[model samples]
Target: MKNKLKEIFYAGLIILVALTLGLAPVTQKEIFSLKWKNLGLQLVEAGVIDQEKFENLYTARGGLSESDKEMLYGRNNRDFKITPENSGMALHMLWAFGLANKNPILEDGPMMDPRYGGAENFASTGGWTLAKGSTMDHYSMHSFVTLTDDEQALVEKVSKGIFRPCCKNSTFFPDCNHGMAMLGLLELMASQGATEDEMNQKAQEVNSLWFPQVEKKSAGCAA
Candidate 1:
């Protein structure tokens, strides 16, 4: 009976994960109604992206909703959604967020692993081309988001649970850009009061956007 129950539980868990990925169109539709204005200002203050540079880059891209403009300038709250059209930008934005957000994970965590030579040498830190200076200038040095002790603990816990397809390690060991970006997303969600379950759900959604092909295949098997 115990073995049977274990199998049943595993089956349910697989189905849930599969369905979540299978319904990507629906699950990925989640929109984050966070204060993106603050995030933008944080990015600028941290030198993650210069204001002039951001304007030039956005304009060159050629599509800006009035809402997008507000996210850049106004203090209004903003809604963010991940789609194929904008996933790359979202990754960059999240990368900046992860870099600037004040968290112990980046400072004393696996990012400091001696095997990587130094934190700044990794893709998460080194690959950031949009920064005004060396990416190390902002690496976990800015107080972009102030989390309470509880929130910090929550972010740390959730980050360990998330993994990106590009790396075998979890976000806690963010050696690559995707892992770091996911760490930033997890921090933002925790600071904004996302519960553990909500954080996990959002992580999966972001991961799906980042790796749709992989998500589709895994989702197909149990769906």
Candidate 2:
């Protein structure tokens, strides 16, 4: 009878552990089966990407970028469709939604998703919240719309001259370029309770400090 009880208790514990693993953040079940391409289609439904823009972005680099796109797009299709499972896909999806209608989707999405390293900051049990908020869409648009063609050519010229030995390419995220740093600073400032007025003042400073050549980078980027 004692041995039988021990066996039953052990079986229960195993079941509990199995359930926990299945529900883990990046488990095989969570990470795989993410409908990334379908999520892209959802962005289309949300009108985040118009047909022209969608085609442009979809065929922009032709399966050659250093980023995960090449690996992600197999002949079958996006085998990994991230749900609320992983932070990376969550961020991208929220970005798509935020980009739509110029809404503060990140706040409603990622900032509320309990992922993408947000627990240490906004929406956590106790972090920070300021009047100045950031949207991932804004960050993306800031880079996209700004930097006119000439400026892009110029920046590309500069980028080529300055070899980022650390950055394996534009996609190697570890490389601390000006753009990434700007986003980080923006997040920090927003969480620090800085007002838009205060942000305007500091925005000028940050643009000069970070993106020296990109004048008025915040023109329509900030909300």
RMSD of 1: 11.6
Runs in model 2 deviating more than 4 A are 1-37, 63-94, 98-223
135 in model 1: Cα distance from truth in Å? 1.2
User: How many backbone clashes are present in model 1?
Assistant: 0
Q: Please list all clashing residue pairs in model 2, or write none if there are none.
A: 34-80, 34-81, 34-82, 35-81, 36-81
Tens-place lDDT per residue, model 1, 1-223, is: 9999999999999889888888423544543445465676658766887777777777788855565555545555556666665677778778888877778998899888888799888888888777897878878888877889999899888777676666667888877888888888888778778899888777776677887766533211121
Point to the candidate with the largest lDDT. 1
Every model's TM-score: 0.76, 0.22
